[model samples]
Target: MSCFEVVDPLFGAYVLGNAPVKQIATGFDWVEGPVWFGDAGCLLFSDIPNNRILRWSPSAGISIFREPSNFANGNTRDKQGRLLTCEHGTRRVTRTELDGSVTVIADGYGGRRLNSPNDVVVKSDGSIWFSDPHYGIMTDYEGFRAEQELPCHVYRVDPSGEIKAVLTDFAGPNGLAFSPDETRLYVADTGRMFGSDPQHIRVFDVALGGRLSGGEVFCTISPGCADGFRVDSEGNLWSSAADGVHCIAPDGHLMGKILVPELVSNLCFGGRAKHQLFIAATTSIYGITLNRRGAQTP
Candidate 1:
């Protein structure tokens, strides 16, 4: 049986008919933040509730990348090929240096502690962007139960170590990614604690100096909320959904869906060709080879 649901003729060109969704790993409490290190020929992802980051390779299989990972959620690579991570337990964002030392990127702002850094992405200009949501601190499941010191907002950190709240209106900001050209930003508002608020993704015009304008609803995901996503070279967004991965065009229309058996939380393009979709679902990791390439920064 085909694992895809074709909604538009354009999406048919993006997927392979014979490429099946393969289960790469299993037996995890929850998984998110799948990032590919093509140079290393490995994929690193967060087993959030397990409080560790796991690494997978085509030849060696799975291994522990980092235990007691501060309940890390989302992850991405910087322009310098350093590992950038959002940690819920630490309520901060961090970068793993090439020398194997962990550097604290962002924790508190304006003398107040951040709620919890949930998802993160690095811009081509060397600026780091992440989302602060209360999900990690709401209970002891993911991180320690503590008082939220800051509102749920998206922040950006410059190369000079300056942190600024770029967007502050989200009840809960989950996943985020930059357009291929870096002229637009897409952010997911999954509502406060995944509650009654609308589950939709918003797009904004990124101006010079990172000034944002024109934040309008880009697309609303159905059967689930948008958790994390990555954009392709054509600016089409492949977002996580309840049933599987939903492909949304730049014009804010649903193009198609890649049906999976589990609830997907996040995804990234991997493989030597950057055409493989690595997915972090509820309790396992899955991958599928696609005909398109991802626009994610190395």
Candidate 2:
């Protein structure tokens, strides 16, 4: 059977008929983040509940990259090729240097401790942006249960190490990414854990000095919320859904779906040509080659 559900004809041109979804890794307690390292020829993802990060490559299969990872959730590489991670246990965002030393990026704001940094992405301007949600500290399963010190907000860390809360209106600001040209920003609001709030993604027009305007609902995910997503070169948003992955056009319309047996949490494009979509589902990691390329910064 076909693994794709086409909603719009444009999606048909982005998918390949022979490229099937392949489960490359499994046996995790809840995978959340998946980042591709083309230079290293490997993919790294977080097993949130397991408190570890695993690396997978075609030649080496699966290997433990970091243990006791402090319940890391989302990850992305900076312009310098260093790893930026959101740690639930520490409730901070950290950067892994080329020499393997970890640097704390942000832990608090306005003299209060941050709830927990969930997902992260770095811009081409050397600034780091991430979502701060309370999901990490709500339960002992994913992280240590603790009091929330600050309101959930999305943050931007300038290249000079100045941390600023770019957006503060979200109840649960989860996964986020920038458009190919960095002119727009897309963020997902999953709502409070188990709350009745709507689950949808929002888009903002990023202006000079990182000013944002035009906060509007871009699209809403069905069957599941938008946990994480990535934009392609053509500005198509591929978001994680309960049933599978949903492809949303720039016009806020569903284009297609990539069906997976597991609930997808996050995904990123990898491979030598940036055509492979590596997915982080509930307990497994899957990958599939696509006809399009990811627009994320390396």
Candidate 3:
């Protein structure tokens, strides 16, 4: 018996008129940072408070990928198919090599430790960008609290291992994704701690050579705020909100909702055809099969 029931008749609005089925993967504390591994035919996500990373597959059910994960929060795959993770416990963004070694990608800027690496994304040109907010460090549940030496900022790491602060004044930048064409970057100002702008998603024009400019308010998710999200092949943004999974079209129009019982934290597109959307909600993991494919990784 499936744990999900399609409450709305328009659940397939984002799929061009095709219905989808939702599957649930229960048992977790706080899940976030979901990334699809197409070659492995599985999905990996973080259980932040549990301090471990878990894997899910159609054939294998669920398993632990890594324990004592340093409170990893956000995850993605690089061009080389290596896992890129943001570790709140260690206060660093790291990359897992193919041979099982970990490389510290970024931990500090200007000789100061990062507040906490929350979410990350890799661009087409191989540049890595992430949001660093203090939410992870402010509480002991996620990571050890150390006095923050620098202000919260969003950073971009070049292919050469150099880190540069891109944006510095977000109340709290949580989840982020790039448009399919790689022309725009959408950031979720979750405002998880401070109720600054509770329902805003900001869009920025990706300037040449891995720079961002022309920041503008993309859309306001009424009734809920945007959490972690991903973009599909058709340029639709799939994001988590208070009500459920909201799909916003390329022109910033609300397409429909995949309502979940809990607050969704992050999501990724997986399955053989890349049409399966796996969501990491508050305490459980849920997935749905979509008719459209997700944006292929660059």
Candidate 4:
């Protein structure tokens, strides 16, 4: 095991430095999707098989934020600081209001139900974006096995409540993140439910009107799949993979790796200063302090 080090200055040589894979908490059955609630001073993550959302904090440790979560997967916060979530069981994107009420955002497109909303993100302008794949519907473990009513596609929900398909024809879209400037989008193509030959992250330029254009390959992972990811203020991409967490530079180059004991599912930045990286791995949750804070939330 390696000792954890705090790499200061975002561009330092040790930014992607390895550290001991300390297991903060365990006993989760298939953990996925994580987001920091700085205002609440807690970290929220999904326990898919348990159908609940778990909360962790420096003081509270672990607690149940919500039960019967409808197999929520990915989570993020909107510009108004509301919690946006993708629920696989319900095949819908929902927003949790400050008063604790859940509002359904989008569950259908073009008169058909979504396959299964996998991961989600909120743009600075208050639009919601998410990936729809059938992983949840095809399995009885993560969520209820249901027949998919629509093809898998990445969808965008405008601020005006209009839902539209942004990208089609991906094998299996897993996770996505926006560039620091919100001018680019990075989406992970996990591909065909564990099939070979198409597991990579694709980058798309966000047009002036927020439409995606100039789709192109961003970078490919080696011996692992890029599941979910986030970007830093310096434009570096931090993503989860089968092996661990891989940090990629803005120029689409591999920089370093943070080895965890399990296949990482998702991660987010938190802490009093928002410099701590909290990861929800397959079976446990781990965290490390970084010298620099993450980029401002989008």
lDDT for each candidate structure = 0.94, 0.93, 0.85, 0.84
Residue-by-residue lDDT tens digits, candidate 2, 4-97: 9999998899999999999999998799889999899999999998999999999999999999899998999998889999999999999999
Candidate 4 deviant stretches above 4 angstroms: 3-21
Error of 3 at 191 (Å): 2.1
Off by over 4 Å in 1: none
Pairs of residues at least 3 apart in sequence or in different chains that clash in candidate 4: none
Tens digits of per-residue lDDT for model 3, 133-163: 8888888888887787778788999999999
Give the lowest summed-lDDT range of ten residues in model 2: 206-215
lDDT of 4 by residue, 1-298 (tens): 5433223333455443553455777899888888998888989999999999999888979999999999999998988888888998898999999899999999898888898898998888788899998899997888888887887899988889999889997989889999988999999988876567588999999976678897688998765878888887778888887777877888788776777778888888887877778888988999887665777993
Candidate 4 clash total?
0
Tens-digit per-residue lDDT, 236-268, candidate 1: 999999999999999999999999999999999
Of the two candidates 2 and 4, the one with more favorable lDDT, higher being better, is: 2
User: lDDT: which is higher, 2 or 3?
Assistant: 2
TM for every model, in the order presented, reads: 0.99, 0.99, 0.93, 0.94
Evaluation by lDDT, superior candidate among 1 and 3? 1
How well does candidate 1 match the true structure, expressed as C-alpha RMSD?
0.8
Evaluated against the true structure, the overall lDDT of model 3 is: 0.85
